[model samples]
Target: LTIVCIVGGGPAGFYTAQHLVKTRPDVQVDIYERLPVPFGLVRFGVAPDHPEVKNVMNTFTQTAQHARCSFHGNVSVGKDVTVQELQEAYHAVVLSYGAEGNRTLGVPGEDLAGVHSAKDFVGWYNGLPTNRDLRPDLRCETAVILGQGNVALDVARILLSPVDILKNTDITQPALDTLAESSVRRVLIVGRRGPLQLACTIKELREMVNLPGTRPEMEASDFECIAKMLKVLPRPRKRLTELLLKVAVETPEETELERRNSAKRAWGFRFFRSPVEILPSDDLTRAAGIRLAVNRLEGEGEDVWAVTTGEVEDVECGLVISSIGYKSLPIDPAVPFDPRKHIIPNTMGRVQKCAGLYCSGWVKRGPTGVIATTMNDSFDTARTLLHDMDEGTLDISTVKPGSAGVTTILEKRGVKPVLFSDWEKIDSEESKRGEGRGKPREKLLDVGEMLKVAWT
Candidate 1:
């Protein structure tokens, strides 16, 4: 029997596990997750309001239910249990930990108050354990976000949504309640690149514009700013613009009709030009807004967009969040690292220097694509693993990973990995808490609060 131990219980891991069982029922698979539960990005990466985009969980759960598979939660690969030990315990091991770190803005004032990373802010709202306590006090009258992706749109919408719509979402209680109490009225989403070069997918773009109850204010000046950027781009960028423009043309009608019935104010979703410096808040200690230098396309070859000369100016705002991108952080030492790409150097899914050991998802291919693409990536890795398993090609099992002391250490140290059952209780309690407030399930942001909730 082929016993496979899969690390990282995200889409890639689950999909690879599913394929192994489906293709070879004789293969017994055990999935180890660092978190107490499954679903990596879907659980913590996606925006809470976007429950539809998160429907991928259903498919992942069904796969995990297979008779040949079992998931061990609260178990880490590198720290708690190393890959070498898993290899010894199982015939083969697959590493599917996706890109785990937030790509930084790489500028000063990133540590300032009211300055938030899209990952930290989004993860906080989405209930990621590490970021659950992150509360940005976005109630400022104006907020600035750097990036032009769906994430930026989500932040903009969340900033501008009526307290009512926000009350019903899966947003953590701290975030939901804070925003409901926030005085923030305006948001500016800044992008370094031209509008045509924006990294958002069309499906994600529509959800922002056509949110259920709110129509965000789009200033004519902002559209003109974006239009200037769009005019300079090549083919697909123009096409994307035409489509977004059509959406804009139809927005006033949507707002007019929605206003006839609902009390929800329009949600403003605007894109600002390149960002130069994050201006401090009116008080100077907190972020006031951003100092932007208008960018112009310069490089005749590679679509280089840079700040032009003497076009610097400031826009007043309260909070700043950078929704730039994601990068993979090196975890497993066995896999060779490429600092440039933040991914393991590999062909398809095979790690270059190491044999048998391989990577998939963001770690192998760099951070890109959605949940579906993660599945496709893992399938490719699984095939390669199977081929290598048959040949007994690479062997690097020198230091065995031991889980014997893990449970004891966690128990003695008072570290409880939120198990699936623990998560269920947390889920129920959050819902009950929300119901108490006449809102949807509100999350407990603090780790102490979460642990207490789990215990109770």
Candidate 2:
């Protein structure tokens, strides 16, 4: 049997397994994940209010239930077992463990109390086990988010959204309680680029614009030249820019004007600004505001860079979240990694200088694109592996014990793998808990609780 082991239970891992099993009937796929629960970012990073995006989990569940596919959760690749060991036990090893590290703003006072990376903040609200204790200080009225990506918009939306809206979602009770009493009414999403160069898609921008109780307070000046540029831009970008123009430049219609006037909260984009420092509060224990260096775009079209103008401005706010991006960390000593790019160095998902070792998703490419992009990228990797096997580049003639061999190693180390069936038990328990709260699922924020439910 051609036994393949994938080290991650996220979208990339499951997508790769789905392709592997469907293409070759003899291939038995095993997925090992660090968390007892499956679906990585879908569970821990996506905003609770966006349930439709979470529907992809159902497809992953179907993949896990395949007779030739097995899921082993609660197993850390580098700690509970090593990559080298998995390579020995399987005909091929695919590392899909996604980007878990955050890219910092590299500014002073970044370690201040009210300063948080968007990853941890998203995790806190989404019931990620590690970030459950992150009780962010929401006593202040204004929150400054440093980035203009979709994640930045998500953070702004969650902070300014009405408590009643979020309470109905699967957001944890503690987070719901904290948000209910939040005094924050203003959110500024700062970026170092112009509207034409925004990283966020139009859908996220539309959601932010239509967010209840909040009005767009964007600078009219930013959209001044954008009108002439729209005709030459791509269709997707043109539509997004037109929307921005309507909100930021053109005079609103009667109904829209009334909505803006009546909004109780406000959100806006601060373009051509880059964070210089996170200013400390009076006691110097937490963030008070952020010092931004004013910038100007140096080039035309998408090939532009922010150039500092030697002028800086400070906006007073209580909380500062850096939503720059995510970085992939080295999972094991044996796997070749590029420290600068924060990704595994690979050619079409084949790890350089290492046979039978491959990677996909964020760890192969950088953390970019949506779930569909990840699916296509993972399929390419699986195809690459299959090509290698057919070309005699990978020797699959010898028997590899796959999960059976890995289980023996894990047993020796006193680490019990949570099987796919066990995860279903945890899922059922969570669903039952959610039924009491009138939500889809009330997530168990504690890993121990998840393990207990699974074992029971």
Candidate 3:
């Protein structure tokens, strides 16, 4: 029998464990999560209104309940236990800790008030303990978001979404209250490249267009260059580009005028712009605006790059949210990591020069893709591990203790790990709390509160 220790309880870890338990019944898998709760990003990163996307949690729940699988929450790998310790107790260790760090803008005035990373904003609204106190001042009317990804769209949607619509979702009460008092009326999503290179998908874009009381503010010139290439591009890109063109240029003048007159809020895309600095208010205490360098695209398709056009412009805004990207952090000194690419050194999920060690998901590949992408990547890693076991590349002859061994070590360190049942208790309590308010769940926003509930 082989004992496998996965250092995350997110989609990657759950998917890998699912495959292992189904294929190799002889294998016992244990998932260790730093948070008291399971379902890392699915619970904390996904927007509260998008309940359909979170339906995957049902499948993950099944994986966690498997007899051969066990979940140990509130277990920090580097702090609570080391990678070497897991290796000594298990036949293999799979590092699937998804990216927790956010890439910074590295510009002036980033430290100013009203400037925040979209990661923290998402976490703040989603009830992440660390961002519970992120009381973003939404008194300003104009807000600027840097990036053109789904996360950027999500932030925009949440900012512009009707309060009544968001009230019934799982959004934290504190965020709900803050947004209710928001005075923001316009959101400008800026991207370095043109509309053809937008990183967001059609679903997210459609949501923005259909948002109640909101109208799209797009410049016709941004779609002129991409008109001819729409039909020639791939199906998804072609559809997305066509949608943008229709929304930006093809709308009837009468209907467009009516929308402009009637809409209470608006969102728009700004292309060919890169942030040079976040301009500070006169008092230097808050973000007042941003300085952007005009950019022009070179080449075509995925090979395109943004080049500065030697012209700069400043747009006045009170809040700035950077949704550029998520970055993976190096786990411990014992594991191999590439600082340049921000990924673990691996070949097809196998850690380089290290036997019985593997990685998958965002840690194995740079942070990108959706849940489906992570699922495929994690399954591949599990298959590779099983292959090695059969081929004798991984030695499973030593009958090592699995969760029991790790539990003893954690107990010795005075760490009370939250078991799978304990997480279910937390889940039930959250659901019960939300039931009274007509929401899916009212998440606990403090670590101490979460542990208290879990242990009880």
* Most lDDT-accurate candidate: 3
Off by over 4 Å in 2: none
Candidate 2 shows a clash count of: 0
Better of 2 and 3 by TM-score: 2
Give the winner by lDDT: 2 or 3: 3
In what order do the candidates fall by TM-score, top score first? 2, 3, 1
Where model 1 places Cα greater than 4 Å from the true spot, the runs are 212-239, 247-272, 299-304, 391-456
> Per-residue lDDT of 381-411 in model 1, one digit per residue for the tens?
8888777766667442433232333445546
lDDT of each residue in 228-262, candidate 3, tens digit only = 98767999999998888878888557966787679
The alpha-carbon lDDT assigned to residue 323 of candidate 3 equals 98
Residue 306, candidate 2: how far off, in angstroms? 0.5
lDDT of 1 at 158: 75
Considering lDDT, which of the candidate structures 1 and 3 is the better prediction for this target?
3
- Residue 419's lDDT within candidate 2 is 94
lDDT of each: 0.70, 0.93, 0.93
Candidate 3 residue runs with Cα over 4 Å from true position:
253-260
